[model samples]
Target: MDITHRGPALPLAMMLALAACSEPLDFDLRGRMGGSVDTSQAALAAVADRPKPDDRGIISYPNYQVAVARRGDTLATLAGRVGLPAGEVARYNGIQTDDGLRAGEIIALPRRVSEPSPATGAAATGPIRPAASVDITTLASGAIDRAPATPATRTTTGTTAPAAQTGVEPVRHKVARGETAYTIARLYNVSPRSLADWNSLDKDFTLREGQFLLIPVVETAPANAVAVTTAPGTGSPTPQPPSASAPLPKDEPSPAAMAAAATEQKKEPVADIGQSQPAKSSAAMAMPVGGSIIREYSKGKNDGIDISAAAGTAVKAAAGGTVAAITENTDGVQIVVIRHPDDLLSIYTHVDGLKVKKGDAVSRGQTIGGVRAGSPSFLHFEVRKGFDSVDPMKYLQ
Candidate 1:
């Protein structure tokens, strides 16, 4: 028998044989379609919601859009995943195509590719049937005709009512460099677990720089909430009222007593010639470094005083306190934060060769580090009460 004459039967036999095999082959007998499937809808569906980002890491805001990178993602990889050209994505973000992205780094989109979708959850893969082969409009109309929908409602004025508001909107916080989930929670007075849940943090509660986090809703404001008072490097003229620190232990001498004992007094009767006067002591706080003030505190300008000092100059603690946190800014410069009495915090920046670590007890004028070397070596000193930045000069004396 000539197989060419039985083409239809041969295909049927082949299909049956394939189905009977241990693993059936998944082949489309329709052959390739002449027209390409449009993927534009899929791209738009990926970021349908406004303001709130989608699971694909796309943030669809009204004015602009952005994307958050996943672990081990590069600009090129992110571009492919977000359906934008790699060059455009890289140029928009001011990074190279192959730049490795921090897990939560923000990648700005140059242009809007899709409008926000009100729909949520997974997006559709593609059109159910290829547009080239089917008359979808005719099929949809037929299906609609067969469907039964004989219900109607009307208001007194014959208008539909608007939907009520849903849950409360949360405050969005951008994770800065050196910020941890715990520190952020503490700053907002929310439990770490709550923050993690709100942000979908991993088991380790890890946070990445530039990642957006939604602050949990609470009945009351946090006790120590950090106000968006002013950007760092801009000083606020009006200092926040200071809160009192915990009372010192009963056995320890008060700061005043320590100060008084530090200064030597003239004995009423001169001691024997061989005897020496008490060694002179200093106050509870002093200048961290002795240098000319290159920049004074200015509200909305300089957040701290810039003291021009020589490189390697010893940086001292301004008061008796414990190191609250040791962090670095985006520039990688080291910052030392010390918590002192009276709810005071002193920040020392641009310092290197740290001698003390976080949580270490430091006394007044103790050496903590040295000034970092630069073209114009200076120590950036800041005094903060609670979460508000204040003039360091007010407390430096």
Candidate 2:
């Protein structure tokens, strides 16, 4: 029998053989993947470290301070700019007052020139540059590479230390034996991917004992966002930082009452309900699914409440909102995030068979998906004011 006519079968057999191979292919055959090419290293190598001098050409470190010479500056000219005597400045660095100086060259000071301050910024070159310094362990273990090196604030010793600049500074965490990156991220209420990116973990997200990792910073809503409703005579209530210790008041007003007050005023505030007080007055969020509360909110332990339900049970929206995002977790469980009025967010996780896509407008009690089938099937429901997760029970009427 002639087999030359069956040419298509040969390609199919080859594909099957490749799929059945014991070793998997390392490189991608198709070229549609993103982030596969990284230019960060090349970009970094192109830049050279330069001295960050203050207005007086002063660069201060913990143990010492130096003055940088500008272009076309001589030793005497540099000394005059920093308000120091030419003889004193030249003598300290063992150079003659008439010696030619190079721009960007450091000249040691005989005494303390100036104290580091927020205005002066951090040093350009030192053991800890305000820009590139990150918490790292010994050289034996991999060093943590915090992307987009965060700026540091000056300390009392004139050295720069991590501090809140635009957002909160990351917390330094030391890795313990037998602890994985996933567990550490969970402990701090951050995503494992974010933790990995901030610390530049290995491909397998590996961590070594005694390795220092920087926990990603989370920026929460501002204090002013808590005052959503204004009581008749009560001035703007004081905003308190959300703490796990302070439980939501059980006797707080219901969402219906708050809605009624808002109706009377003919204006409803934007939906930023960080504290229980605003949640007490805002429109209540209906339950997402009919089930028993299997787990309650426990701050860092559990950001949301878990409601037990049968697999494939219908999951509905807790409040009217625009679908903000639909994403999958590391375990492939679906997460649906909805943005409600006044900047409130309702999050439903462990969902499946989503009927609504991202950007869909959903009404209160509207069905969005079904509970994912699995052992101990349950829906995780969360209510967040800005990025801060609040108690879901407080928002559910």
Candidate 3:
């Protein structure tokens, strides 16, 4: 009877214990739910982490259009005309030898990347964009002509007048018994009037046999300036004379002093030497072993860098084009120049022997010569912008 009576009180006691534990247990349950929610949020974040696709299209770079090679063009000259380095032109076109360029042939140029389209949401990573189509139909075939001239100025009070027209500076020419003014003028691109004016001759003056006439240097006038004609009876036109008020000589020396002066005559200034032409691009047929650069381009006295190699090593053309000039300097070193269709030119100097001749068509990496024995077997390579020398490294691969 006593046990049955306690059952009702036991249930009440159990309810009191459960009520006391409910608050703490609810907090623990909430924490566990929060952790699961954080994990789910992390998984959603990972799904959204991938990079988006770029919308921009393929961009183009600046590229030169290949022009048909003309006769007598060299890589150096072509590069100069096209405003690129000869070496660079070679490298971009995969010209390992100079023989790749040939007259009437086409080649690829170093292209730049095009501007990125904003709507596409993509950007170009490399060079500037180039035109899709180049107008090679109007390719430049010759050297650029003289620039246009400027307006002439009128002399004001106290202002000095410009010099009178003169002929080109006197070049050493053997006096031929039958040579006349007209013949000489035509050969030198000088006008007959300019020659006559330079010699201070009358209109009817005749060239004397065995007499040397001083050629007056011709000054290039601005494009818009009118060419001045020579006055009749004036000896080769006189250059603008020096001002009369300039410094005077201290005194004339005696005969003995004069003799001393004669012994002490000043030496003539050295003429500017033109750069040697490179081997034709077609001559660049062979590849050098190991493909290590033997010479580097430089701006100092060397002009080009010399790559070290053994004598009798195979010498390859640096660009594609026609072999232009091949000659040995006073030092007995051989030099070659190659002209490209693009008007660029390359120069190879200090070679031992030349295998190509002037006017022979060549391609990139063609062999034009070999290193001579006993000579420092090195390639003196250069890149020319037209006739001007530039750093080859700027255009080299």
TM-score of each: 0.36, 0.34, 0.32
Where in model 3 is the C-alpha error above 4 Å? 1-213, 222-300, 374-376
**Which residue pairs collide, candidate 2?**
270-342, 271-341, 271-342, 272-342
**Candidate numbers, best lDDT first, in rank order:** 2, 1, 3
**Looking at model 3, which ten-residue stretch has the lowest summed lDDT?**
139-148
Candidate models: Cα lDDT each: 0.57, 0.58, 0.42
Candidate 1, residues 1-397: lDDT per residue as tens digits? 4556867888788779768954224242221233342221221221111233455666554345567778999989988877899997776555689988767555667776554332422232111121111122221222211111221234469874221111223456767888876667656656555666555566667666756676665543434444667788898766432321122223333555434323311112122233333223444357888799877786434556788899998888776776766776444577777767665667788889998886666666667899988778888887766545577777765
Worst 10 residues of 1 by lDDT: 125-134
Q: What is the lDDT of residue 68 in candidate 3?
A: 31
Q: What TM-score would candidate 3 get against the native?
A: 0.32
By lDDT, the better pick of 2 and 3 is 2
Candidate 2 has a TM-score of 0.34
Tens-digit lDDT string for candidate 3 (1-397) = 3434778776576557646852211112221233322111111221111112122222222222232333455555545544566787666544442443334333333542233333434332222211110111101110100000112334567563332211112342333776766556545555445555544444454554543444433434333444568778775754432211112223222345333322322222112123233322222222321135644444433344455667767676554465555665434656666655433556666566576776565545556777655443455566555434566655553
